[model samples]
Target: MNTTSRPGSPAGLRDANRRRVLDAVRGAGAPTQAEIAGVTGLAPATVSNIVRDLAAAGRVEAGDEVRGGRRVRAVRLVRRAGVVAGIDVGHRHVRVALADVADPAGAVDHAAPPERVEVRADLPDDHGVADGLDTASRLLDEVLARTGARRAALRGAVVGLPAPLDLATGAVGASGVLPGWVGVPVAGRVAEHLGVPSWVDNDATLGTLAEQRWGALRGVDDGLFLKLSDGVGAGLVLGGRLYRGPDGTAGEIGHVAVAPGDRFAAVCRCGHRGCLETLVSTRTVTAMLEPLLGAPLTIADVVARAHDGSSGSAPARRVLADTGHHVGVALAGLCTVLTPRRIVVGGELAQAGPLLLAPLHAALEAAAVPGTVRTAEVVTADLAEHAPVLGALALALERCALAP
Candidate 1:
């Protein structure tokens, strides 16, 4: 019996439509049948039939939920097999998360979405790839134990690094920016250790993927996700997809010169002076206040002081606002070139909330082209610290199809 069918044949058309429905649910988190229909442009009855078949096959869970005061049938993916992993290797911490994988062929009888969990582990101020990889492996084992899944149950992993990463060779692409890990095939090593299919990208780029799928960039075709921490970096979502340019470093916006006058005078790690990163990073912001307080300070400490709402804290708040102004100045140029619809602010500094955003917005208004500034709305990130890891998970789900 032949199963193959021509593209125009009824069976082929049905398979294509079923895929359309699956992609809609997988990408949109959980959406009502009506919303899925709207996205896929499929008739409600066809969507209902495909969804029912899928639910029967243990690929998704469907239920009645209230939306806008009316009950609607909503659907979401359910994990039926092994777990997919997301690892975020930041400058000073490694955060990891896992979610259940979808059943590829109705192999399991499940009705609920898979549970998800994450853990963050701190590293010393300076550690190399070996230390980071060891820390990540231990956390993976710990989380796997919590899920009652053995190491063999791991299906796929995606790593997000805080450096320019070459996807083809799975190596950190640049030097000076991330000295300890430079030129290291960190992604390849992770994949070898995990014994599973794996992928890697810049941590900021992953943040962009997370935002597009689950946070501020949802339904946005053109947007940016910025991680403003010890250093500045950006994730670009152009034409509704993550764009890494030709060499996979599209959003290294921190090095873009933002300071006035000579761009070569202020020394940056990249050997450039007056780079945006030299001025607006977490360390730079805290350095400004450490003198007045007569003590060492972290960005988190500065943000806490700014939020305490005391006269003593006014200086802290003012510094953050000023930092935001500098950030906005650089973004004005970015907005001019990209004309993104939205810009999401993440990282530890974004914790300052309006203290950072108000001035940031003001600076953009003062600097950016009037038409471009109005086209982009700067907003705080929704997922916060968890975003990069989630983005890795999103990438894994897409690349591996969560099938195994």
Candidate 2:
């Protein structure tokens, strides 16, 4: 048999196809053989053969994942052993995740899907800066040990705080939110505990980062990441990068009024009446529904009731729809000003899914500038609750690449 490596030769064509399969695996969102075939324009059988050969040689790992209520084969390129940490400090809980980051110098983005040895932990939202720092430090050590990755392999850690962090001053804003965290250098504290460099940013901003890199907002240069959890917040991804303004308050859309004249409007934490945050946060929306249901309901309960097939699901869904309507009202002005290409609705309430998005879409269509609604799309977050932590990991890898 001829063994010439020319592109027209059988061996060369197989090699080229194999390379295409590898490239597809390295790209974002192409995990299954069918997906790889779509990306590389290769036959499904050809992609499967390449994947099988790669797995046999230990160049890739194949696993099963459930998507759309079905099992699919997912494949990923084997990566060199290196680790990074992402920490999410919520108002009432702390979540830490450790992920493997491949060589940053690779041409394609290094994909860090949750690993088989994936390790995540929840720590109590301890009070006081010192106590939180101490607990976080201990948890990082435990996580590293559990993953069997040497602590020395850690490149860096990125911490996301619920409160806004001024990129210029390295100070926490929204002092009333995390009062104990005020005036504290959270990144510095994390660095001390992990004995490695650390970076910090607002949790919502991190969510934006994660989504743009790996989730629904991927491939879009200008987009908005709207998080509607305990409080309302947003992160702007403009020019393919997170656009934190000079004071790092660029995406503070929450304080903008969306219901200025409504009778239900209340004073917001920012001392403003009818602010979007006052109307759309988990607390406010649930409070609005509790009276209708004749009982106090958590955001989770509302989401559960809104998921269809539940008794009286309409009431819960109506509450979410109303909240979405207000959010869309606020977003209309934002769209008019910034003209983002897409809006990813995230946070706890996003779990309500279509119940929220439908009304949001309807409101945006009715209120936005004549052509504005056509330019932007509103959708739920693909990363869902994990966006911040994954985004922290993405930041760690990116910053490490820039390190001298």
Candidate 3:
């Protein structure tokens, strides 16, 4: 049996064609060999040969029978034949998920742990990056061991980081906020430590991928995914692909200006005043609500109060509504350009559900182009807080699906 050629200039066209076939199967959920050929615009014999090779390599599996009398051998991704690990490194926490390449719905092993360093403004970035990487590697090892997956069977690994990434080198970009990670090649280091192939991208980008694949953005071809957690960011998906843009910084909406002066008096980690993050971040909302509630509050606490409609809920609602307004303002321009079919919001702040969405909907209605707004659906992430980790898993699956 002939194996797919390794990715290289000489074999680039073959690799590209193989990837197209794999993507066709993944996108359509499952397809027959004929269907794969039709969708991918490849020759039937080529598709048959490719599928056979993939099946032998444990990347895909053949299912029984055809819908009609066509003798179709149904083919679907073999999600469990090999394992892949996904790790999410956030500002305040780290999460890990272990999944198989053949069956995405199969039992997934997961772990979540608080950031290794104390949550403080003064903590060095190096400490956070080093500790986070260490914690992620350990968690991945545990999940693999617990699931009884062999290291040799690992297909790939993907990580979601809280900061921007240099896509070319897989290094952390200049986010000023993430201290010790300025020049570190995060993906390379993680792969070295874990002894497996690994890839990394911005957390919001992964969340967007997760949402698009399995959540609110399901069938939409173009959309925006906003994550409102300890921080604020957006993910852009256009033309049915995650758009990282030039330098992998396409969706840094958190730093979009929402205010003009020092009147708000809040400085953002990006060194900007009146950025959207300064107004809508959990920290800012909690601070604003604390005085009104006459008590300390966490983001979860505020969301609970907002949901319960307590007298104290008013302040939290107001903050979230205002944040929604700013988000809508920034998104208006994006909607005009991308014209997405939906907007999926995720993160800790989105836990307030309607409290955050209602205002966001209103603001978007007010800000977006009249007819365009009607074409777009704004909703919360169906996977909620798990979006990033799931996205990482999806990324891993994507890599495995295209493996030669």
Candidate 4:
């Protein structure tokens, strides 16, 4: 005897068909049946049936529309059921975003420009963590209220930190970059403060995700994101996914030894001598400039001075060029092994633009093999400093799916 299933009788087939139709509708706003068929690669009959079932279950809305002189039913996803939050914690600032969970792509725009508040990264006292967390939570609440969303409407939140995280214990790695937060469970604290589930990742990794999703790195499977701020860090995108490695330290390019035996080598926060960060980080450049400038100066001041056309900017430009050379030397090794298709530089130093990137390119060409150096194109990040926070929103929206 032949066992044949009736129409829509096999549960698995129906579920798969439903998912395909749902995904197509979500991807294409208000698509006709023929359009949905083309997008999902399904027959017209299958598309019609799936749309009918989805409409009945209140998962989608179908309306009559005329397309090319013919009548067609347009299908669209129902409005998102809940909201999600994205939190980015930098060395000296915190940024947060509130967005709709159902439409992750649109979450980055909920706050338009996002909200940021500066706090000391050193955290010299015991109360630093609590105070910082409270400030971030308050900013989150302000943005939620501005967006006409209640705190209870939040489904989840994603937090980005400037340091690598131990995947197993949810703690910052032993880099000593974040002295006050080495052992603190950042995700847990954010979750408790906001009364929503929270997740954490390195800020550079999140920046890579944001760029791949919404900025210059779109469609690039092999790409590298370098964030040169108070400290230097990197994020890698390989095979269309973020590579965290076994211990979530795959992108710690800052710690790679570059000027190990230099006479003026400075100790890195990680307690390493002459690491790449020691030579290329904004902090290092600032320290190098303080004596010549006759006073302590911020990284922004240095970049501004370098852009100045006067004689005073000569020292600043020289230092930045030298820093770029060292950074390119470290990146050359990475390019030899990974051979990424693109390199996006963000953070404070990136604002130096050609002043920094030009020297970096020259150094990379001088160091790496010609073939590998030619394959990767280095450019400034399109999303700029907001990349990490936008990436956090994308993470929350993708990971926190609510029931229909």
Report lDDT (Cα) of residue 227, candidate 2. Answer: 89
lDDT of 2 by residue, 1-404 (tens): 95446868887687667666766776654388888988889988888888888777655788988989999889887774467788877765566787765423222253444452333444454365665666666677778888787889777899888777767545676666566788787787778878889999988899998888778888899999998887678999888878988788777888888767776678876666788887788877788778766576878788877775566578888778898998888888878778899999998888888889989988988888878778788899998988887777778866653232
* Residue-wise C-alpha lDDT for candidate 4, range 1-404, written one tens digit per residue: 84433456786476557667766776678899899999879999989887877677656789988889998889887664567777777666777777765443333323332232222223223234576677677887787777677788788888888887887767787647777678888888778888888888888888888888778687789999998986678989999888888888788888888877776777777887888887887777888988887567877788888887766599999998998888889999889888999999988888888889989988998998788979788899988877888788777866664233
User: Which candidate, 1 or 4, has the higher lDDT?
Assistant: 1
Which 10 residues in a row give candidate 2 its minimum summed lDDT? 103-112
Alpha-carbon lDDT, every model:
0.80, 0.76, 0.76, 0.77
Ranking by TM-score: 4, 1, 3, 2
Indicate the residue-level lDDT of 219 in model 2. Answer: 88
lDDT by residue (tens digit), candidate 1, 1-404: 97665688997798678778877886777898888999999999999998988787667899888889988778988754567889998777898888777632221112222246799898776578888889999999989988888888787899988777787787887776777888888767888888997888888998887777778888899999999976689999889878999989888888887765784557878767788888888878888888875478987788888878766488898898888998998888888888998989998887888999989989988998888878678899987867788788877766554242
Residue pairs with backbone overlap in model 2:
none
Residues 270-346 of candidate 3: C-alpha lDDT, one tens digit per residue: 78887888888877788888888756787789877776788977776778787777778878877877788889989
Q: Which pairs of residues collide in model 3?
A: 78-101, 78-102, 79-100, 79-101, 79-102, 79-103, 80-102, 80-103, 125-180, 126-180
TM-score of each: 0.79, 0.73, 0.78, 0.82
In candidate 3, which residue ranges exceed 4 Å CA deviation? 1-52, 55-80, 104-127, 291-296, 369-371
Poorest lDDT segment (10 consecutive residues) of candidate 1: 104-113
